[model samples]
Target: MLTRKQMELLDFIRTRMGTDGVPPSFDEMKDALDLKSKSGIHRLITALEERGFIRRLAHRARAIEIVKLPEAMESGGFRPRLVAEAAPPPPPPRGALAIEPVHALELPVMGRIAAGVPIEAIAHVSHHVAVPGSMLSGKGQHYALEVKGDSMIEAGINDGDIVVIREQTTAENGDIVVALVEDSEATLKRFRRKGNMIALEAANPAYETRLLPDHAVKVQGRLVGLIRTY
Candidate 1:
């Protein structure tokens, strides 16, 4: 098991590596963690290595490698990565995959769903995103949704933007959530609750705020990012 410090360090490494395509150096980790000295960061890495949580190049300068998870686990669970190439290849890439290799996460354009006034456009799935699998809650098992309307224009969400939505059914107040409203419509808006009233506030004033009883609105997912393609 990883200790708190080791786990935190591990998280930093994984996040940076997965997203930035590089592992953080000892100095970067030191500064990120606010350690008084670079040695402080090294001490933590040493501890992690001792715990079988990470590995490093033998006498290789600047080589701090962590043990990556199995391919099955990498695609199935949440495994933070600080370095992008620390592990082996995942299953062969699917030919139809649209994302580039350097991006952190690439989501398939499923189809478009309504965001504002619900249109009937084939919703020509706008584009894909480069995000980490760990960024989403359910890993590769997670699917993508095409945004349909402009109800969330105020939130910077526009028509045809492929939103990275985490699959979830519950969210905290003030979270930009993808809600299945009345079980018939899915909306992307700010979650607000006041006793019995639940309001989905559209960031853009062009669309009116949606309000309903708590029972009438259900959380679907949280907005993670927007994918815009040329």
Candidate 2:
């Protein structure tokens, strides 16, 4: 059985998609449900997904597919629609070589990592997300992290964006990386070496760069690519 908020969110999505041919944005959902923050909407969406009423598409902005509806909604003529499908690519010119289709691989979305303040260390996979194979960096293991704050926005990373990271222990100055701090929290920031200390720099000026002893910071992975859903 769905919670009252979950049912309301599901119905809102259904109504918006029926009229707009696409699901509403997170902001829209938040407003419709009178939620205090987008996090509430995220939780409601996840509940619906786990209950088999919806599915979130990977690598697409605001791509949600309604899989099933409650009996009341069904009686009202709601139809399931796959909203993430992209139109076919254009054919190559006669003299040019044909491009191969892009292949997708599923990678574990370990959990949300902070782009502002450091969050609890992510220890286990929360879910899987399909990523384009081309997005994977050279040969090493890669994983995805859902960004949870706006401190990296100036670097093109934003809250709610899923970042694809290549597993690595070392990074050059200015490289965005997931840094485990003091072994208890993890944050996404640019890595810098300053004398014997390591600087975790945020791209947004609103946040000050955090400098800690080199031994206190552990480089978990270097960011290679990013995915965002509108």
Clashes of each: 16, 3
lDDT of 1 by residue, 27-124 (tens): 88988766678887877888778767678888776676768532322343233233344455466667855544453655544356577753332212
Off by over 4 Å in 2: 1-99
Question: Over 4 Å off in model 1, which ranges?
Answer: 1-106, 118-141
Worst 10 residues of 2 by lDDT: 76-85
* Per-model TM-score versus the true fold: 0.47, 0.58
- The Cα local distance difference test for each model comes to 0.63, 0.83
Winner by TM-score = 2
Clashes, model 1: 16
> For model 1, what is the C-alpha lDDT against the true structure?
0.63
lDDT of 1 at 151: 76
